[model samples]
Target: MTYVFNPTYQLLVLASAFAAVHLLASGRTFIFASHTILFAALTAVLVSHGIEPYQTTAQAPGGLWVKLFYGAAKATWWIGGALMLVSSVRLFLIFEGRPREGRLVQDLLAGLIYTGAALSIVAYVFNVPVGTLIATSGVIAVILGLALQSTLSDVFSGVALNLGRPYSVGDWIILDTGVQGRVVETNWRATHLLNGTNDLVVIPNSTLAKSQLVNQSSPDETHGVTLTVRVITSRSPTQIQQVFSTILLGGRHTLREPAPLVTMGEMDGQSIGVELAFRVADAGQIITAKNEMLDLIFRHLKAEGLALATSVPNLGVPLNITSIGSAAADPSDQHDAIRDVPLFAALTENELNLLTQGVTRKTYARGTEIIHQGEKSGALMVVTRGVVIVEKELGNSRIELNRLSPGDFFGERGLLMGAEEPGFIRALSQVSVLEITSEDLSKILHARPDLADDLGATLAARLDAEAEYGVATPSMRRPLTIAHRIRHLFQL
Candidate 1:
């Protein structure tokens, strides 16, 4: 007679209750990781007390009277233990910050656990010969493996990549094929990258493993930028290196710690080449820093009277000799510099001539401060040669506010409204500037009251930009308000 009630079945029910409790508490995995391990141990102990799951259903005593029920109990116990082992592995991975990365390893471990449990169920519950079943499975596994050889390669490659960790999420990497992007996610099959065009690129792990990769974000995020400039061999290379030094110094975006490197490269019959190497804060700053460096190169080249070599060879490099700026600019050249300024573009010829009458050309040695922060100046200064940096001092360090190239004007706030300068202007190299005093400005404005509108608007816009970039609190003062202030200040 088949027994309706069995003590062994009752024990299996109790074990199931414990497993339910563990599952219900699994939400607090971090806190319960240790508890899970202990619960796995307990399940293991209870499972061992039974006729080992390796036993066949026929081997279970008849006194239990229900062979089918005994087989199910054995399978349930082993299955429960397998589940607990998988949970323990998951819990450990969670503690190690998995699923973010190294996800494949966890899945592989869980799969192994399930495979073992399945094999045990077949052997103990169904009275199947373990050796025969394994042999059959081995053949099937071989057939499946051959069919999935490509997939297996990707799987193993992913495992290697995760373990090696050449790049992590958010790291910008450059591949051998020039596909560059920031790593967004990595999975068992492929890695996802957000490229510069903001498009998602999915690369299979096997292919990625085979290709050469460069991690730009490694060893800290500072990225090195190298730029090349070729110039006519009119000037000494040492002097050119000095000029390049000034160019690098004027780059507000380049890092100062590594020290900009200027190396003289190959010299042909026509021209010589120079390579400038520098570092920027990160990959994101590369474009901005490169643009700044190119602008500074042109400004310094013009200031030093050096000419960039023409691409058309054999035709001879025609240098733009408008003015050789190495020496102090004469009155005529100074007038041209001031006149070429966009701010004074609207002035009539006579009006521009009148504005230059009292303009004085001043030269400052490299590392000289043209104007201190909060200083009141009665003159408007325009950069005629070389570069100047507007810097805001904060505690021990200084922040670069802006860079002034040729024809760029400063000291306007102090000259126009008698207001203090917002930051200190320092000559990054031996720089030449044309200064127009308030006396000359007064005469010009008297002749043209309409000029106040342009000057005031320009001044307001500059202040607005400075406020946006620097630590200065932006004022609510509008350009119209500033134009009125200029009119009132100049008594126009």
Candidate 2:
């Protein structure tokens, strides 16, 4: 090892050490950095030892055995230099932007570099004629190219796609051939996509190159959704527009910048037509946004005493939540909303009416703060119209905890346990709610003791949800602890 320090062997020893480090760094981030160092060391060693890898008649230095070792070392040095060239191309890609999309170009360049290095080794080390070799290889290339015509087309098409960057990995694309999916991988021959059903789809680059494609994530990630709704003449056109406007404002899954739109269409003797057009964050959010908007439509319509046209077509759009909000809610809207409440699903008809009687209806416009974070409210509130978003602040970031629609409940923690809210609740649109004071809710809990069991479990779940969103709460005793608290608070 001490010989490494001797001037005669120092350059060789340093080159060998750099090569070892480069090999050790393979498959890691340090490989590219280490490759550069090894390349420089190899170049220095070859130049110092009077061995030129590029010179066809370059002598290997010393005796036969030493010449043999020098030949191998010179070949290794050429390969190292090729790798350094490849590394520079990759570094250029990082600076050029779109490192991910430029991978195909980088790889193709690396292959060419290695090929050139191989040709150089043949001429310089073996003293072979490259002109004859190039001529013979041209004939073989034509034959292979003809045999693998389709594959070659795909390879070239992939190169074109990477250079043009029509779509990158993670973009949702739809081919004219009716194939729609998110791009998960792209290789030499094909683009792999993960479809909505979680199935992997591989399409040859040749086909993708020819087929017309719509990139849903292009220009931006936001995608538009259009829904047509028909309403009976029971409500005015102005009223319908106002309610639909509220839906867009309250939508949590939709984008805000592009701004949602509502257009009044032709009206017939049976009903009036309206189109609700909005843009969601992405194609993946379309269904969620639709469902939430539909629910809000029903709740708002029911609260405002508007009804869907009797002749409204099914249109293949499945209405998931049924049996409660289907009919027009006018004379007893509060009673029906209370009946549909999941928390009071098991309550007697008379009990529901009793709770409904005590509720004081309240309303708020868009952007109004309904419940402030850390505020203690002595009343229980149930949403009767529109939507509200619950948001919590954690240091510098503010996260939306949840969105509440009609019939959903809140303020239980304050009313039952007299605790502060885990987050602030703000009205996303024109909102209306039925507020039940502690005195009113207490009477109902005392009247129906069985309700204590259900409300307690529901309240515990609500608190648990808040705890998950950067808030702290006690280890709630699912139903029992909450029920006991209700009894103590209300003196039941």
Candidate 3:
């Protein structure tokens, strides 16, 4: 005789198992809770209809409602229990911080367990032969497989991907067919990607499994970017390398550990190609970093008198002086940047234009050392854009004296005093400054003697203020007064 279970008692035990699974599962795995609720509903229907093992719908007494409820409960109970069991296993893996990539395996195992149990119950309790049920199930499976061929392809492809583990969720990927985005979700049928434009792109698992993909976020987030530009052959390779290295080393987004590399690339008759390769903090910041690098390169070439190579009327012809400076920088911008300087405000419009003509616009990336203390370069710099920090070395650490933004000026005291730099100057951001050599200032001072007194007073007062603020001001023994130093240095 086969043993039979009381309907109410069996349901209570099954409900308790599902409830325990749901309670122990991690909150991130919502599938477990959903499947548990479904299983509980099925159990409730079976209890209400008094359906149990060995109880058949064929022997139901009177109402159609009673028979319908019994059939529905019987069909759904085993299938719902299988689903809940599979989901519970997945939740357990997730809670343990293990890979949940064996979802297909869990489903297959659950199906096998449910099928074996169903067969045993039918054979023992209802006296149905197991061989006949196997034959019937085989025929139904063949028909369903043919009808759902496309779905099977996706399922198999998804299984392959899970096993391979090419790209996971939150990874940025680029497909060969030009679809680039962050992977948001991967289901059995399709993978959904969220793109830079904030749109969702859904690709079928079968299609993705066959396509070529580049994972930007695999291994690490550090992304390498290369930029190439052709510079005229007039500039030496050493000068070009120095300019490129400075730009890369001080870049805000660039990684310093790998240390950016600058190499001389292909060379033609008129120009030589230069390449700058560097790694940024992450792949997402590449676009912003590339744009900033281009701006810095353009300005640096202009400052160093290196012009970008362009197509000439004759392939082997050299560029003229006028054509060289044309693309190097905009003369109008240089003039405007010069006029905005307060030290030059004492000069007339014509004098300002003359000074602007002599000025060179230099670009410095963030963290670049613009001027070092005790360096003998007496060039005056006027900030046109971005920011810089002024500091002096005190013992081991450097003391920050001030921050200079756009329209601020520095290094004028060095020019007037005829001495080395007093403090260290560093670029705090991508900075552009108009630099005027002392030679250029000397010419303007010779033209107007009265301008010397005004500039000297300004420079001396600035020196005294910086000294008061703990910045090391260089002491040079030369002139009795600030005005004398300005006059003697400018040759007035």
- List TM-scores for all candidates, in order: 0.73, 0.83, 0.58
Clashing pairs in 2: none
**Native-structure RMSD, model 1:** 6.0
Give me the runs in candidate 2 sitting further than 4 Å from their true place.
Answer: 1-23, 26-29, 58-67, 95-97, 310-328, 363-373, 387-403, 422-431, 439-492
Model 3 Cα shift for residue 254 (angstroms): 1.7
Where is model 3 more than 4 Å wrong at Cα? 1-84, 95-127, 311-492
lDDT comparison, 1 vs 3, better candidate:
1
Please list the C-alpha lDDT of all candidates, in the order they appear. 0.77, 0.77, 0.70
> Residue 138 of model 3: what lDDT?
99
Ranking according to TM-score, highest score first = 2, 1, 3
lDDT of 2 by residue, 1-492 (tens): 011112236546756766676566554346667778777776776676565666766564467866666567668878788877777777775514657667788889989999999998888888889889999899899999999999999999999998888999889999998999999888899999998889999999999999999999988899999989877765678988887787676677877778899998988665787899999888878778899888777766666667776452567543232222555556246777777677777778888877777788888998899889899877788887778888887788778877787778888888888888878889887778888887777677888877777888887777676676647557564668889887877777
Whole-model alpha-carbon lDDT for candidate 3: 0.70
Highest TM-score against the true fold, candidate:
2
- Candidate 1 residues 130-189, lDDT tens each? 789888789899999999999888889998998898988778999999998999988878
Candidate 2: residue 352 lDDT (0-100): 80
